[model samples]
Target: MDVLLERKSVRNYTNEDVKQEDLEYILRAAMSAPTARNTRCYSFLVIKNKETHKKIAQIHRAAQMILEAPLAILVVGDEDKAYEKYLPQDCAAATQNILLAATAKGYGSVWCGIYSNEERAKAIEKLFDLPTNIKAFSIVVIGKSTDNRPPKNGWDPEKTKYEKWK
Candidate 1:
C-alpha cells in the first residue's frame, strides 16, 4: 500500500547510473506477474545506449523521457507464446509490477506505451532488429529522480459500483 501510494511517474532524472543488481531485482518482479493460462508472453529488452535512447525518443513525443533517463526497459509481448487476446493484458500486468518494484527500490520510472501505435511499434522493431514473432508493448524509463513530487490520492469512491449500474 505504501509503495502504491508513493508511486509517481518520474520523467526528469539525475545523472546517477542504475546498478545492475537493482535492475535484476526489477526484472524479477516483472517476471513474477501473473499471466493468462500461465503463458508468459513477455520479453524484456534493456537499453542503456545513448544513441538508442535518442532514436526511441524520436519515435514518440511522450517517450522523450527515455533520453533523460539512464536506461529504458522495453517490454515486448510475444504473440506466438500466448493468445492474441491476452498478450496485452499479460504485458500490462508485468509493466505494473516493474513500476511498483522500481519505486520500492528508490528508482524513478515512467511507462511509455508502444504496442497500440503501429508506426511506433514498427520503428522500434526495426531499430532493435526484433524478430517478427515479438512486438514491443511498452518501455519503462528508469533512473534517479531529479526532484521528488508529493503523491496524490487516486481513490475515487464515486467511480465504483457496488453490484450493478445505478
Candidate 2:
C-alpha cells in the first residue's frame, strides 16, 4: 500500500540509467495486472534507441520527456487475442499498471497518450509498421528521478455516482 501511495508522475530525471533487472521486474509486475475476460492480449515495445525515442517525442508535442528519459515503453494491445472496441481501454489499463509499478520501484515515469487522436495513431502505426488491429495507445517514459514531490490522490468522488438509475 505504501508503494501505491508513493507512486507519482515524475518529469525531471537524474543521469543514472535504469537497471535492466529493475525494468524487467516492473514489466513483469505490469503483466501481472488482471485483464478483462483474461484477454491477456498485450504487447510491449521498449524504446531504448535514441533515434526511435526522439521520433516518438515528435508525435507528442508536450512530450519532451521522451528525449530525456532513458526508456519509453510502448504499450499495445494484441488484437490476435483481444476483441475490438475494448482493445484500447484494455491496453490503457495495462499501461497504467506499468506506470504505477515504476513509481513503486523509486523510478520516475510519465504516460504519453498516443491513441487519443487518429492522426497521432496513424503516425505511430506507420512509424512502427504495426498491423491494423494492434493499437499503440500509450507511451510510458521511465527513468531515475532528479526531483521528487508529494504523492497525489485522484479521488474524484463527485465525479462518480451510486445506484440512482434514472
Candidate 3:
C-alpha cells in the first residue's frame, strides 16, 4: 500500500542494470491485470540494449527517457486475438500493472504513450514490423531512480453518483 502511494514516474536512472528476475516479475504483474472478455490479447517486448533503446527513443520523440533507462517495455495489442470493443482497455490495464509493479519493486518507471498519434505510432509499427492488426499502446521505461516522486490518488468525491437519479 505504501509502495502504491509512493510510486512515481522516474525518468533519471542509475548505472546499475535491472535484474532479469525483476523484469520477469514485472511482466508477471502486467499479465495479472484484468482484460475485457479475458481476451488477454496484450503483447509486450522488453528492450534492454542501450543501442536499441537509443534508436527507439530517436524514433519516438516522446520517449526521451528511453535513452537513459536501463530497461524499456513496449506493450502492444495482438490483433490475432483482439476484440474490437475492448482491445484498448486490455492494453491500458496491462500498462498500469507494469507501472505499479515497477514501483513496488523499488524501481521507478514511466509510461509513455505512442499509438495515440498517427505519425509517431506509424514509426513504431515500421521499426518493429508489427502486423496490421497489432496496435502499439504504450512504452514503460524502467530503472533505478535518482529521485522519489509519489503517485497521486486523483479522484473527486463530489463526482459520486446516487442509487437513483442525480
Candidate 4:
C-alpha cells in the first residue's frame, strides 16, 4: 500500500545506474500482470544506450526526461500474439506493473505514452526497426530520482459511484 502511494512519476534522476537484479525484478513484475485471455503477448525492449535515448527524446516530446534516466523499458504488443481489441489493455497493465515494481525497488520511474499518437508510433517503430505486427505501447524511464517531492493524495469521492450512476 505504501508502495502504491509512493509510486509517483519521477522525471528528474541521478547518475547512478539501476542494478541488474532490480531491473530483472521490475521486468518480472511487469510480466506477472494480468493479460487478456492469458495471452501474455507483450514484449519488453530495454534501452540503455544514451544515443538511442537521444533519438527517442527527439521523437517523443514528453519523453525528454527519458534521456536523464539510466534506462527505459519499451512495452510493445504483437498483433499476431494478442487479441487485437485487448492489446492496449494488456500492455497498459504491464506498464503499470513496471511503475509499481520500480517504486517498490526504491527507484523512480515515469511512463511515456507512445501508441496513442500515430506519427510518434511510426517514428518509434522505424527507430527501433520493430516489425509491422508489433506496435509500441509505452515507455517507462527508471533510475534513482533527484526529485524528492511527496506523492499527491488523489482520492476523490466525486469520482466514485455505487451500483449505478445516481
Candidate 5:
C-alpha cells in the first residue's frame, strides 16, 4: 500500500544508468500481471540506446523524459496473440506492474501513453520496425531519480459509488 501511494510519475532522472538485474526484475514483474485468458500477448521493447530514446522523445511530445532516462521500455500489444478487446486492458495492467516494481526497487519511472494516438503509434512502429500486428501501447522510462517527492494520496470519497449510483 505504501508503495502504491508512493508510485508517482518521475520525469527527472540522474545520469546513473539502471542496473541490468533491476531491469530484468521489472520485466519479470510486468510479465506476472494478469492477462485475459492467460494470453500474455505483450512484448517488451527495451530501449537503452541514447539515439533511440531521443527519437522516441521526439515522437511523443509528452515523453521528453525518455531522452533523459537511462532506459525506456515500450509495452507493445499483439492483436493476433491476444483478443483485440482485451489488448488495452492487458497492456495497461502490465505497465502498472512495471511501475510498481520499479518503485519498489527504488527506481524512478514514468508511463507515457502511446496507444490511443495513431501518429505516435506509427512513429513507434517505424522507429522500432515493429510488425503491423504489434502496436505500441505505452512507454515506461526508468532511471535514478534526480528529485525526491513525498507520496500522494488522492482518494476521493465523493468519487466512490456503492453498489448503485446515488
Candidate 6:
C-alpha cells in the first residue's frame, strides 16, 4: 500500500544506469500482470543506447525526459498473441506493473503513451523496424531520480460512483 501511494511519475533523473538484475525483476513484474483469456500479448524492448533514447524523445514530445534517464523500456502489443481487442488493456496492466515494480525497487519512472497516436506510433514502428504484427504501446523511462516531489493523493470522491452511473 505504501508503495502504491509512493509511486509517483518521476521525470528528472540522474545518469546512473539501472542494473541488469533490476531490469529483469521489473520485466518479471510486467509479465506477471493479468491478461485477457490468458493471452499475454505484450513484448518489451529495452533501450539502453543514448542514440535510441534521443530518437524516441524526438518521436514523443512528452518523452524529452527520456534523454536524461539511463534506460527506457518500450512496451509493445503483438496482435498475433492478443485476444480480440484486449491488447490495449493487457498492455496497460503490464505497463502499470512495470511502474509499480520500478517504484518498489527504489527507482524513478515515467510512462509515455504511444499506442493510439497514429503518427507517433508509426514513427516508433519505423524507428524500431517492428513487425506488422507488433504495435507500439508505451515507453517507461527509468533511472535514479533527481526530483524530490512528493506523491499526490489522487483519490477524488467526485470521480467515484457506486454500482451505477447515476
Top candidate (TM-score): 4
lDDT at residue 163 of model 4 (Cα atoms): 97
Per-residue C-alpha lDDT of model 6 across residues 1-166, encoded as one tens digit per residue = 4789999999999999999999999999999999999999999999999999999988899999999999999999999989999999999999999999999899999999999999999999999999999999999999999889899889899899999999
lDDT of 3 at 58: 86
Clash pairs, candidate 5, are none
Q: In candidate 5, how many Å is residue 145 off?
A: 0.8
TM-scores of the models, in the order given: 0.96, 0.88, 0.90, 0.97, 0.95, 0.96
Q: What tens-digit string does per-residue lDDT give for candidate 5 at 96-166? A: 99999999889999999999999999998998899898989999999999767765678899999899996
RMSD of each predicted structure: 1.2, 2.2, 1.8, 0.9, 1.2, 1.2
For model 3 the local lDDT of residue 106 reads: 81
Residue pairs whose backbone atoms clash in candidate 2: none
Between candidates 1 and 2, the TM-score winner:
1
Candidates' C-alpha lDDT: 0.91, 0.82, 0.85, 0.94, 0.91, 0.95
**Candidate 2 error regions (>4 Å):** 155-166
TM-score (C-alpha, index-matched) for candidate 6: 0.96
Error of 4 at 107 (Å): 0.6
- Clash number by candidate, in order: 0, 0, 0, 0, 0, 0
Q: After superposing candidate 3, which stretches have Cα over 4 Å from the reference?
A: 153-156, 159-165
> What is candidate 4's lDDT per residue for 1-166, written digit by digit as tens?
5898889999999979999999999999999999989999899999999999999999999999987889999999998989758999999999999999999999999999999899999999999999999999999999999988998789899999999998
TM-score of 4: 0.97
lDDT per residue for candidate 3 within 1-166, as digits (tens), equals: 6766777778788867889888999999999989877889998999888888877888888788878788999999977787766877899999999999988888889899886777877888888899898888899999999875546766687778789556
Estimate, for each residue in 52-116, the C-alpha lDDT of model 1 and write its tens digit: 99999888789888887898899998989977589999999999999999999998999999999
- Worst window of 10 by summed lDDT in candidate 4: 78-87
* Off by more than 4 A, model 4: none
Worst 10 residues of 3 by lDDT: 147-156
